[model samples]
Target chain A: MRTSFKPLAAGVGGVAAALLLWQAASGARAAGGSLPSVGSVATDLGALAGSPDFWSALAQTVGIALLGLAASGLGGIVVGILVGSFEPVRYATRAALEFLKPIPPIVILPLVVLILGPTGQMSWFLVFLGCLLPIVMQTVDGVHSTDPVARDTARSYGMKPVEILVRIVLPSAMPYIGTAMRVSAPAALIITVVAGLLGGGPGLGQSLYLAQAGGDYPTLYALVIVLGILGLLFQLGTRVAERRLLHWHESYREVAH
Target chain B: MDKLMNKRPVLWLLGIGTPALLLAAWWLASAGSTDTFFPPLADIVDRFRALWLFDHFGSDVLVSLRNLVLGYAIAALAAVAVGFVTALAAPVRWAVDPLIHFLRGIPPVALVPIFISLMGFGPEMRVASIALAAFFPTFIATVDGLRAVDRGLLDVAQVYRLSRRDRVVAVLLPAASPQIFSGLQVSLQTAFVVMIASEMLGPSRGIGAMTLLAQQSFMISDMWSGILLLGVIGFAANFLFDLVRRKVLAWYIGSRRLARAS
Candidate 1:
């Protein structure tokens, strides 16, 4: 019993120790320059819970992240599958995609800002580019990995090409697409935040930047917590969704002896 | 589908052709643009050559690379060490999981402010930010990798009377390397971005700072140049790392191939 509880107890104790150390550090730094202690940060979080501005900022960032995700996910899968279906199209675009994939989408931030003028549009574009390549690559792999024997069987059965693609190929591809969504979701959020901060867009990132610039350390730290929670929720939500969707997948099953 | 392609010599055309065409198209399309915000591609290239190659590669680009290399190295080493230790101890793992998870969720870019206040807006701050950004992914990977080591393998190690150091160094690290490499790859990418972002966040002498300055000063061509240079470096760095990863994983690949054949 002691051993079993040791891990959990130790975990909690570690966290408490960390918080205490942080409080001490901040307290020491107080004379050099002002910084909030762990207690003060907790207080700020409570104060923020009751603030409308905090809620709005949360909503704004959430809205952008979700919108960007949905748009990129759908567009990417559709276009990816479409391109992946044809050998010529896949081969032709492979070079361009490969070249572009290595380059971070943030490279286009300046141009995006120039064209979109720091609106949610700016963030959307950034998020779109961030999530696009992964989705496309996964979709292409999904299509490519469709069992040739299954394709031959569908053909032998006189199934239409579309029928084979939809009935046979799409299901096989679902796992890959799910993985892609999981992989891309965090990227979409990170880029959205970066876009907001740099592009002057409407999101928690922009707000965090503002707080920092204005010397609102409490608000800055609070927003960081908020963003962290948002990221965790997004990650956890996608993981749950992936697990549910892929429950039947062999890969999702527990390891066999 | 793959076999039929052997009859044709289209690989080169398909592989490099499209990107080349796209590049040409960009140059042509932007040739006549009067927009002050977007200079012609040719002009941008010229600016890129002048600014990055001639003017600030030594000063700005080197700084970025220095920060990236040191930070990423620190992140990778620290992650593996910490992960290895935690994997050996369940209590420590449990104690630290929540904290790690919470920190992992925070966008690395968002920590720039906290780092700025704590470390100040200097090279130290930038490197610290980059290391912080890169650390979580690698650490998670290392822990996952170590944990994912086959139970039977550990049993064999024990039966063989392998010491803990031998068990980890000779058996576990190699076995879990694929996951570790994946984590390192992500760390490489994250470190570069964080390097740039931190520079942009503060008054620093790096390509990120240079780009931000150019944009603010409305040096459209210079901004484009910086963007282009960054894109190339990001691409090349990832490509090179991927090659190294492939080389390191050759043994694993061969084993998998043999398994599949059998």
Candidate 2:
């Protein structure tokens, strides 16, 4: 429960030690191959920061991820609410959803490429499909977890289905929605990169794949570092949003901090 | 009459209707397009039958599944062992947490080229890639499961003077099973995804490679068939996991049912 400095220090130390080992291994490999030293990778990382291509790719990656996430978030919430509310709908749809949900959308890249022609459009489609099911399922679970009393009361008050959904159901499901967003955000990024790698789009993923193919260790390492940073940023942002939005929820309450 | 009116068929219709409608719309929209991109639904189905089922596309599916299972099993075993040791020791947990987080944050796909360069174009490299993909989720889940064990339960064990091994096996393992199972579900999904991606990039035998080959040959329908097969496999894995979960965690399911009834 406690986030003490000692544990933090220990965790950092562990990471450093792992990196040290990696560096040593790379050094040994350097004798026979083009292994970039840690310092050289750091320099490449700095150079990447200033490069127009890197910035463009970063922009493209972030743009696709955000767009796909937005689409999924909106579509998922709507479909999830519909599924959660109507029992007949839920019963009828459960099997189909189960059948469809687990299928990795990444496998359809070639199909998407065939249809959409390996464009940014295909990239967006891939990322959107990758993140959709999780977000939708989480939203449905959230909606289902809402207080039975509140739902009944709204029904008794002659609240229209749409009204109850927007006012009563959605508000209650915010926590779950937030959690879904947090989970899906990383997924969106990863899928976007994968799309780029496979479809030859201008993103961090494509750059990394190209660098790897070109055997540019320094650039590959640099790109990997950047990807890690982006992931960290997403996690931190999600935590901040979750705390601010769901402060009243029991799950978000600080433990006498 | 009212009871008959509320039959399961009505429920089934409700669920299938929307997706069916969607598919119909898709078929209609793409009906006129003779382009390779928008192959009609009928064409895809025909292709699916010819390429995947009737023509015996078993080798590709088997290869991918074999890699997925072997890699996931290895990763699950190793991660569970390492995660348990770390969980049992606060020092180890603290020491390794950051490293785990760092590695986990880096998407497994990013490591494909590295694995290829290191291990070359072989099953070993594919297995390693899948293992890397599976390891983090399982490790994190195991740690979470261990941490989430009720302290009061541990206290009870201590009062009963249970051996450390007994405490872990009897008390901790059952309590952690749900979380561990969730991790397994996630790891399995991840392994399959990574398997396809790795094969697409490097190898020549799995579903991913088949998709790539179909693309290169301009066999759009064959590519669609491969994609459809992958989807079916993914769905089957998830459905099977759910069935296993129901059986293994019957107590959990029973409790839920009781709560709902009350």
Candidate 3:
């Protein structure tokens, strides 16, 4: 316990040192009028925390991310299972998936903004597109990795196709699906923020733009801090959820011992 | 799976045919489209040829590419350098761990706004934002790769009394190359996205800015052409990266293949 606490203390010290550096740099540069000190940013954060509008913006961003993730997660799993079950289907779709996967979501930002007109729906849809391909690929990998022997045995034992899929394939795919969720959750948040920032969608990102446009440097910096914390929380929450849900997985079992 | 892969012609056919088919379908389906937002593929292709291939190739595409290449190079070199120092020292790693995590957690696009504040809509801001955003993945991966080097390999190196430079070059770097490449791939993608985001957020001459401007002014075909160029560049980047990876990791991949076969 003592040894572990040492690293934590060191980490806190590092953050403090970084803050000091930021403050010093901002103070020394007379031309850095747009750059605010850490103290002022903190004060702005405190004031913003008391405001109702900040909370709504936070809620809206979270809502878009969650809604997008849920939709993509469901869609990916269903498609992944169907495709993975048939080798020919996998080959048929591989080219399309590979071509589409590497294109960054931002490339479509202009088109989506035009069609949807910078609404929450546009942000939500962008997040969905951003996350869907990775999840589908992961799920397909998980399904392909299902035990062939076990599958054959189930077939020999008179299990129906759907029954085999439900009992055997899905359980095997959960770990991959969990991994996809871990990756996509943060991505969903990032995409949502990008949409707001670039497309003028309502959320903390738009608020950030507004602050920057208005030359409220303190508020802009404060919102960035909020986003950083929110992202950290998302990461931590996903890790915890993955551990809890995948406790029976071999990786977790090995860790437990 | 092995059999399917061995049939090179069939694999090539499937690989090339699918995308070609999709494009053909899109062209046929949208031939008479009346929707302003979803213009006919034919018109978009014409604009793509005129604008991207001829007119703005140097001004927009080449400019964006130069910034991306410079930023990515700076990030990769800096991350590897700093990663070596931080990973070699235990106390430094602990001290900087949270800072790295926090900085990485902030959406890469969000960081662009901070840069805009500090640097104020210059080329420097775009490059700085891209470099910083692209830095984290490679940095983290380098540290992990260095730390996870085989203990026995180090023992062997020490037993041979190898110079520090030789040990790093021959053992540590070769071992870490695969992981570092993966991280670099992610960084490239991040850099591309941030490049677009930065240009879109600022008044710029890049493809992203042109696309947004066209959209706002209702030049639907021009906007589509910009997007089409972006998509092509994105695909080409990944493909090119894979080709380089294959060349660089040829020995590692060959050894793995031999191991699997035996």
Candidate 4:
């Protein structure tokens, strides 16, 4: 526990130094610029914390992110399981997935806005596309990496493919699936916010966009701080989940201390 | 029978069938819609040809490619240098690791407004944004890679009385190459996405800006064309990098196979 304090202190010190640098730069720009000083940004953050709109915006943002993540998680797992179980399906879908995967879903925001208009649905759609590939790819890889001996033993016991998948393959793949979720969660948030920023819907991203458009530097800074905190929380939550779920895995076991 | 079932024809159909089916379905769903919301696939293809293949969209694509390459190069160089320095010095790593991790956690998209404010609406801003986005992943990967070098190899180098620089080049770098390459691949994809996002928000040339302009004008077909171009650009970059990785890391692949076999 004492050892942990060192890391925490180092982290806080680094952030403090960065903040000092930012404040000094902003102060220098005070001669003539739209930049807000660190103090003003903190004040703005306080004002935002006191406001109902901030909470509502944050709730909306998190709601969209979670919804999108849940949908993509389900869709990706189902598709990944199908592809993993059936070689024909995997081969058939490989080209399509490869073709679609690298294309940034943000590029399709325009097409989505044209079709669905700027709505929560459009934001979800963007998030779904962005989050889907990483999860599916990881799932497929995980299933492929399932122990051959375990699979053979399960088959020898006359287990049906579905039973084998659910009981054996899934348990083995849980660690990788958790990793996939951890990876996709941040992506889901980022894409959701980006979709909102591009006028998809009302969320923290849209608030940031509006602040930028209005040239309200303090609000923009405050919103950014909010986004950062949200990201940090989600990352911390995922790290905790990973440790709990993957304690048996060698990688996690090695890092446990 | 199994061999016949796995013939080239079947493989070809398996590879190409799904996208073709999806495209056909899209065509059928939007057939004869003239509200410009859903143009026919034919019209979109025509628009793609006219705008991207035979006109100024080529230049915009080139501009984006140039920025991506320059930004990635600068980021790769800087990250490797800094990562090496930090990896060599425990105190420096402790001092800098927190800052790097925090920035890495902050989504690159969140920095666009701040970047714009600081750097103004110029190419410098765009390049800097892309460079910053690429830096953290590459730097983190490099540090990890350096640390992951085999302790036995370092011991051997020490026994051979190799200098620090010699040990890094002869033992550490070769071992770390694969992980570094993986990081670079991720950075490449991320840099492209960041470039497009920044271009869409500001400035006036790039596939992203073109898409934004087309959307604002309500040219749905043109917008699709821009998107198609971006997808192609992304695919080409990935393919190109894969080729380069294969060439550079041929020995790494061989070693991986040996490890798997054992």
Pick by DockQ: which candidate is best? Answer: 3
**What DockQ does each prediction reach against the true complex?**
0.65, 0.56, 0.72, 0.54
TM-score of each: 0.96, 0.90, 0.95, 0.91
Candidate-wise lDDT, in order: 0.86, 0.83, 0.91, 0.83
> Residues B1-262, candidate 1, lDDT per residue (tens digit)?
7777783467567767777888899999999789887678999989999999979989998888999899998999999999888888887898898889899999888888888866678898888888888999989998999888999999999999999899888999998899999999999988988887888775779998899889888899999999988988998989999899889999998989999999
Better of 2 and 3 by TM-score: 3
TM-score of 4: 0.91
- lDDT by residue for model 1 (A110-214), tens: 778877888988898789878988899889989988899998999999999999999988888889999999988888888989998877888788888888888
Clashing pairs in 1: A11-B95
Pull out the clashing pairs in model 3: none
**What ranking emerges by DockQ with the best candidate at the front?**
3, 1, 2, 4
Candidate 3's displacement at residue A52, Å, is 1.0
Models ranked on TM-score: 1, 3, 4, 2
Question: By the DockQ metric, which is better: model 3 or model 4?
Answer: 3
After superposing candidate 3, which stretches have Cα over 4 Å from the reference?
Answer: A1-9, A255-257, B1-15
For model 2, the superposed segments whose C-alpha errors exceed 4 Å read A1-5, A30-35, A144-148, A155-162, A249-257, B1-9, B16-35, B40-46, B53-59, B259-262
As for candidate 2, its interface RMSD to one decimal place is 2.5
Candidate 4 per-residue C-alpha lDDT over A124-177 given as tens digits, one digit per residue, 9 for 90 to 100: 888887888878977887888899999999999999988999988987877878
Q: Give the DockQ (C-alpha) for candidate 4.
A: 0.54
Which candidate achieves the best lDDT against the true structure? 3
Candidate 3 docking class? medium
How well is each residue in B1-262 modelled by candidate 3, as lDDT tens digits? 9886777667567767877888899999899999888889999999999998888889988888888988989999999888888887888999999899888889989999888888888888889999999999999999999999999999999999999899888998899888888889999999999999989986888889999999999999999999998998899999999999999999999999999899
